[model samples]
Target: MTMKTSFAFALAGLALVVLALAPLVLPDYWTGVLLGMTGYVTLATAWALFSGPTRYVSLATVAFFGVGAYTVAVLNEVMPYPLVLLCAAGIGMTMALLVGLSTLRLAGVYFVIFTFGLAELVRQTVSWWEVNVTYTMGRYVFLPFEGRHIYWQLLVLAAVTLLISWAIGRSRIGLALKALGDDETVAAHAGVDVTRIKLLLFVISATIITLVGAIQAPRWTYIEPSIVFNPTVSFMTLIMALLGGAMRLWGPLVGAVPLFLLFEWLSVSFPDHFSIILGLLFILIVFVMPNGVLAKFDDLRKGNRA
Candidate 1:
C-alpha cells in the first residue's frame, strides 16, 4: 500500500484502539471529557468538509446546528425521540436551502457576512418565541430528557457524521464541489452547476450538524440564542480544520484532540484567562503555522536533501 494509505490505516487503528481501551482505563470524569471532545471533533470535521474543500468559509455553520437542536427540543414535548432526530435533519436541510439560495447570490466576503447575518436573524427569531411562551406568545417550548441518553445518542451522531463526510469526500458531488472551489468561473463555465453543488453541500452539511444539535439538546435539556448562535462554533471549527490541515479528510480530528485537551486543562487550572489564552493561540497558529499543526506532519517527517 502507498505510504499515505498506510498512514491513514495506522491512524484509524490507533484511534480505534484508544477508544476501545479508554473507558476501561480512564476515570469517569476523564471519560466524560473525551466523550465531549469526540462530539466537538465531529462538529469540526463536518464544517471542514464544506469549508475546506470549497474554500467558501461559512461562518453561519452553526445555524443549521441550532435549527436541529431547537427542532428536537421543541418537538420532544410531543414527538418521539427518533422522530425528533429525523425532524432535526429535516430542519437543518430546510435552513440550508433558504440560506444557501439567498446568500449564494453574493460573492466573496459578502457571502460570509450575509450568512452570518442570516444566522443572527434566526437566533433573534427564536428569542422572540420566548415572548409568546411567557405571555404575549402563543406557544411554549420545553424539552425533558436525561443526560445519558443524550451522551450515547451523540456517539451515534458522531459516527453518522463521520460516515457521511467520508462518503462526500469520495463522491462525484464532492469532486464537483472541490472543482468549483478551485475555480468557480471555470467550473460554472464547464456546466458543473456550481450553485446547485454548493446548495447540496450546504444542505448535507447542515443536516449533519442538526443531527448533532438534536443530540446536544437532550443533554443540555435547554436551548437559547447565545449558545445556539455562538461565534465560538465558527472559531473552534476553524481552529480544528486548520490544525488538522484543511485539505486532508482527517484533519479535523488531528486538530481538535490536542486543542481540546489544552482547553480542558486551561478551563480546570486557569479558568479566568482561558479564553484570552485560547484566542492568542489561534492568532499564533495563524501567524506562525497557517497550514495547521496536523497537516504538516508529512513536512516534519521529510529529511534533508543528500
Candidate 2:
C-alpha cells in the first residue's frame, strides 16, 4: 500500500484500539460524553454521504432524526426492536423521498430553505405529538430509565455509520456524487443522472440515520419532543463535518471528539459563560481553519516537507 493508505489504516487501527479500551478505562462521565459524540457521528456521517460528495446541504437532519426517533418509539411500543429498526429506516427513507421530490428541483439556497422548513415542521410536529401522547397514555407514554447500555448501543451506531461512510467513499456513486457536487451541468453533460443520484443518496443516508435513531430511543429509555427534534443535533453534525474537513475519511471523528469534549468541559467549568465561549470558539475555528483543522494541518505538514 501507498504511504498515505498505510497511514490511514494505521490511524484507523489506533482509533479502534483506543475505542475498545475506552469502555473499560474511561469514567462513566467521559464514556457518556463519548456516547453523546457518537450521536453526532451518526448524523454527520449520514449528512456527509450526500453533502460531502454531492454538494447537497441538508439541514433537515433534525427532521430525519426526529422521524426516525418517533418511528422507533411508535413501533417499539407496539412491535419489537428489530421491526422497530426496519420501520424507522423506512420512515427516514420515506421522508428523504418526499424531500428529494419536492426540493431537488430547486438549486442553491432555495433547496436549503425548503429542507430547513421541513425540519422545523418536524420539530413542531414532535412537540405536538409529545403532548398528545402524554395525554393519551398518561404515565406510560415514555420508556423507563436505562443505564450504560446506551453507550454500547451508540458504539454499534458509530460502527454502522463508519461502515456506510467507507462503502460510499469507495463506490462508483461516490465519484458521481463528487462530480455532481463540483458541477451539476458538467455532471449532466457527462451522462450522469444527477437527479437520480441525489435522490438515491438522500434515501440511503436517511435510512442509515434512521437505524441509528431507532437504536438510540430504546437506549435512552425515554423519548421527548425537544430531545428528539433538537437542531443542536444538526448543528453538531455540521460542525463535525467542517472540523474533519468534510470530505476526508476521518474528519468527523477528529472534529467531533475534541469539540464535544470542549463543550462538556466548558459547560461544566464555566456554566453560564460556556455558551458564549463555545460560540466564539466556533467562529474562531471556522475563520482560522475554513478548509477544516485536518486540511490546514495537512497543508502545513506538506509545506514543511517541501
Best TM-score among the predictions, by candidate number: 2
TM-score list, all predictions: 0.85, 0.85
Write the residue-wise lDDT of candidate 1 on 89-199 in tens digits.
877888788878887757858777876676688887888876665334222345454444455566666666676787787788878877887899988888898888777
Please report how far candidate 1 places residue 1 from its true position, in Å.
12
Roughly what TM-score does model 2 have, to 2 decimal places?
0.85
Candidate 2 C-alpha error for residue 133, in Å: 8.5
RMSD of each: 3.7, 3.3
Question: How much lDDT does each candidate structure score?
Answer: 0.73, 0.74
lDDT of 2 by residue, 93-124 (tens): 88789888878867867878887787779877
Q: How much does candidate 1 score in TM-score?
A: 0.85
